[model samples]
Target: ARKNGRVGIVTLAKRPWLTESARIFLPGLDLEKLLDELQIPVFYAFEHVSRRVASFGTPNSYVAAKRNAMSECLAQLFGEAKQCSSAMSIGDSEIELLAIQELMSELAMSRFSTPLESPLQFCKTVLLRENPSLVQLQRQIESLANSLGSLVDHPGDLSLELGTGRRLRLRNHLGPNLR
Candidate 1:
């Protein structure tokens, strides 16, 4: 494994029952310490690799798999950070976050009684009626998407900046042009 151009070796183990099954070895950083600091279980890396191998083919190398797993973990961390920051901006407590989670859960469970043109429209209607505070957040998200212009239509061309000083490219495997 390599972190910031520094070459290191990672040792991973799999155990079906253990929570922190995966392990890593680096020159300066301790895997257990790092995971503790990040507040993420070591098994997250294993879970990521397992899911990737199940969905796609096995990775070419352990290093590649490790890098991909780390990328996924970092992306998740950044997403949580973005959500927390947005929620904090709205209020001091976690009410906004909890409300958003509840709204998403409700949306997922809802079986729209009436036929709608699109699921997005249905969601918008529900949000407008159920939670007005989320309307501004939705608009902000839509504005961000709109700023991407044509990239919004072509997911393969979309690259998301996760506020981690890195750009994550959306790969469209099923698309005719895989770039």
Candidate 2:
């Protein structure tokens, strides 16, 4: 720690027992080089302590401290993994939707048959905004609304869960085209 609260001097010796996997993953991580690049005045904390006269920690203590740090790091990594998975799923759904939309547009344009002059026909054309993809997505969403809605709403009280715990329930909210 420093009086100005910017940085403190510290020295770290590389653990010789670092695994091959770690070396492979962090091939370019040179701690000394990093410290040098930072240009911070750093020093080893144990420089004044006589190594031969002092044995401060046991292997268990070291393991526990490392474990705590590793757990926090793993938590961050898992969060990133979840985010990446969600993004990937959304991207995949978008690609599929685009493909379906293209197919529907081609089918709609290819057909030259005259649409019947009925209220239902006119309503669909208006409601769907003349986009076949939108119409298809709407139908899929409406079809799932009943079944999925029941699962989300409490069977007895019909109360809804309002947090991230209800994420699965919102799966239908993404719409049928996304699924």
> Could you list the CA RMSD of all candidates, in the order they appear?
17.9, 26.6
* Candidate 1 clashes between residue pairs 3 or more apart in a chain or in different chains: none
lDDT of 2 by residue, 105-135 (tens): 3223333232221111000000111233656
TM-score of each: 0.22, 0.20
- lDDT tens string, model 1, 53-154? 635533343334444443343335455311211110111122222333333223323424322411331100011112335665566457444543333233
Candidate 2 — which residues are off by over 4 angstroms?
1-5, 9-25, 56-179
**Pick by lDDT: which candidate is best?**
1
lDDT assessment of candidate 1 = 0.32
Range of the 10 consecutive residues with the lowest summed lDDT in candidate 1: 121-130
User: All models: lDDT?
Assistant: 0.32, 0.29
